[model samples]
Target: MTDEASAFVPGHVTGFFSVERTDDPTTTGSRGGGLALTDGVRVTVRPAEETTVVLDDVGVEIGAVDRVLDALGAQATVIGETDLPIGAGFGVSGAMALGTALAGNAVFDRRLLRDELVTIAHGAEVQAGTGLGDVVAQAAGGITLRLEPGGPMENRLDAIPARSRVEYVTFGELDTATVISGDTDRLTLAGEEALSTVVAEPTVSEFMYAARKFAREANLLTAEVRDVITDVSAANGEASMAMLGETVFALGDGLSSAGYEPQVCQVDPAGATLVDDRDVDGEITGRSADGSE
Candidate 1:
């Protein structure tokens, strides 16, 4: 019996975070986390002759998926695809890991609980140093507000009302591990302040404004990013630099006029979901939500 499942997750922008570490393993997670974006990653799992992972976009080996398979004591071929640029602060790595864990559990017939799967994926990301609170935020979906952090269930989450359009431009990539591992005292303080300010208002405009302040105070904005933000602002649009990447996310039009085409997306309200590939009695038999088999 060959079973298959697929999951799609939205990307996120972490305005700021207060990191925490623990040897207890069970009680480990981040704190004071931030928002989720609309564009993200999708992963598919199916039985294979051997365990393997293929990232369709970058063609790279996914250690996070490999780690999940190892922990579950199951082998499957996993495929991840993302329109969002990797390592450009789109939270692609976290989305990939979370989607893989969810889809692989279904393909392996593990029957793992939602929180359990999130823990596995979240742990893999933390160990890999690819992200901190992305797995949690993506798991919750929408414009997430992570009040407290750890894993899926362990984190306290809220959401702002979804915006109509979210747009972004990518010029290059940044090493997330290097940036996250650095001294973040000032960044943490700035993030805390931004979090407090946004929590009071909690509008998309306020969030973006707070995020831009955090970027400037955290010293994460590059010259190119700053220039793009300035140009977009001059054109009467709100924009902010994505955390840990050299990418700018603008809220409206006028970026195209600045010689940069923006990729427009909407907020994904649903987090990860299992794709029904119903193969019954050795016969492919299943009707999709749209009444297609």
Candidate 2:
């Protein structure tokens, strides 16, 4: 029985923002928040020797994995997996990376801070381009507002408590890389400007509202995306797409619409953990820590 840890999937608002390109990523800040929902991915880590590895839907990438191990001078294998829909604007990759990295640290018997873990994960995403500033939201969970040009280099970690419950209504997969690659310059500019606005006055509700308005004005939302979100809203859920495309998110809960059994999730303040007994069975057992039995 190998030791391991699993982290809960926290819904994150994967919205786009502007930045301040000052050759300093830390100067960046998030302009707004977007629809964040849950994807099922429980990242796990196992230790063997002095090495770290990451596993995911797109197979394993060892570059960042090795960097983490080398940086810590520790020995371990980091494993990550996400049933969380890929390209759904849910930040599955970022979550997977962060979860796997933490697992590696644990396996190596190293107790690094969450901010430290976030830094490493962000670096990995930057290299992979598999994510945007979404890594910040995914790592911090709840309503996370990141400054433009965010990264560990910038030392940015801001948590915004959501005034409302936000969820995502997924329609189809958005090719994240395609959107990013196709409009690199435009998006970068947009992101930078948005960040500047938000950094000046960062508030979850204000930022999100402004972001949604900007998205509409910029025609960033595709016809299909807009229609889906509109239709879903009539049934009682606010819907929005990921940065470029690929995933749509629906906010709020208790929604009963046909063809969609909206998954119920909330902000997981407790990021990730591991259970010693993997053999535990199907019956509902423990009560929620909040005593919501």
* TM-score, every prediction: 0.88, 0.72
Give the per-residue lDDT digits (tens) of candidate 2, residues 1-293.
Answer: 33765554443546665433333333333344543344435666665654445556345554545555555565665665654555566666666666666666666666887668767766665555555566566655456656434665564556555544444556667665565545445655665555566667676544555565556655578777777666766775555566755455554552335246655455444333343345756422211323232
Highest TM-score model number: 1
Model 2 scores worst on lDDT over the 10 consecutive residues at 284-293
Question: Which residue runs of candidate 1 sit more than 4 Å off their true CA positions?
Answer: 24-27, 32-35, 257-259, 277-293
What does candidate 1's lDDT look like per residue over 54-102, in tens digits? 7764457666667777777777877877677888887888887888888
How badly does each model clash, as a count of residue pairs? 1, 29
TM-score of 1: 0.88
Model 2 collision count: 29
Q: What lDDT would candidate 1 get against the real structure?
A: 0.74
